[model samples]
Target: MGGMNKIDEPTIERARRGDHRAFAAIYHAFAALVFSVALRISRVWHDAEEITQEVFVNLFRKFSQFGFQSSLKTWLYRIAVNTAINARRSHLREDARRLVYEKTAILREAGPDPAARLQAEEEANALLDLLPQEQRVCIVLRTIEGLSYQEIAEVLEININTVRSRLKRGRETLLAWKQGEPK
Candidate 1:
């Protein structure tokens, strides 16, 4: 396959047979690219680091399954994208559950000194949770991650106009929420 010069057949066979050095060589060659993709998609350094590790671990386990029908880079790219997106979705779901718990906890605990900062953060997160996944991701990449419109499009692998439309719809939804209107 194309771009196979970075990894030879011997190394692949060794890695498939559980050679640590062979695996390390593969990791060294692709870790940066994997991490870069993960960071762009997840927008969190910590999550990106975790995703990179998870990808390599997965590669080690599934090394024997490499059929060589495609370049290794392409396969790794697919894995990183899927892993990062799944991790982001999983995190959002966990955040939603945690938000429910925190809301209930706040209601139960009556105190004049409930931190305003924490309340504001929870409100922001709740507002974000109201958005659809696609729009929310675009909004986060644009607003929270400080990515440009073109950058968001590139990272999301979408057309620039699609990125713009998602951001516009997301903003409209947030505005409606602020105005106490039905979304």
Candidate 2:
């Protein structure tokens, strides 16, 4: 059963041809991780779920081109990141824009009292708002998701040095934001 933990690239290759079960298994294996990527990128559970569904739909649609150039997890995350960004952008539409804004506001206000612990989580999310999407994604992938620089580079399709630059710049930006704030 040890082999169960690993996806068979050959099986994936067959699935690429027309195997529905293989695709279903692949989806089951990666959905949570993809959802986590969506959540981290989006900073909201509902948006993440929506993004996760969209990612899977897109993945299945684009399955024939997966190419096996990267691990399935890496590819899945790349898809998740791309789809989440696109969906987040699309959420600005009349159908999604008002709902997104309203939901974000509700989450921000639905917390309990201004206790220090609660405030800390809220503050961190607030700080992330100050980051550009690329930097935020780099920090989240490196620090939060514990992906290697190479993995992040593959997922983001940027050079390794660019990942380093983004992580550094992201940390500095967060530090500056923190430092510039009232105590």
- Over 103-138, each residue of candidate 2 has an lDDT whose tens digit, in order, gives 344346555653554556566667766788899888
Best by lDDT: 2
lDDT of 1 by residue, 67-180 (tens): 776556667766777788898778766663332323444455576756764485467667766788688777766675555786566556689999999999999999998899
Model 2 spans with C-alpha error above 4 angstroms: 1-5, 92-123, 181-183
**Model 1 Cα shift for residue 39 (angstroms):** 0.4
lDDT to native, each model: 0.74, 0.75
Taking all chains together, each candidate's TM-score versus the true structure is 0.52, 0.77
lDDT of 1: 0.74
What local lDDT does model 1 show for residue 128? 69
Count clashes in each candidate, considering only residues at least 3 apart in sequence or on different chains. 0, 0
Best by TM-score: 2
Give lDDT: candidate 1, residue 100.
33
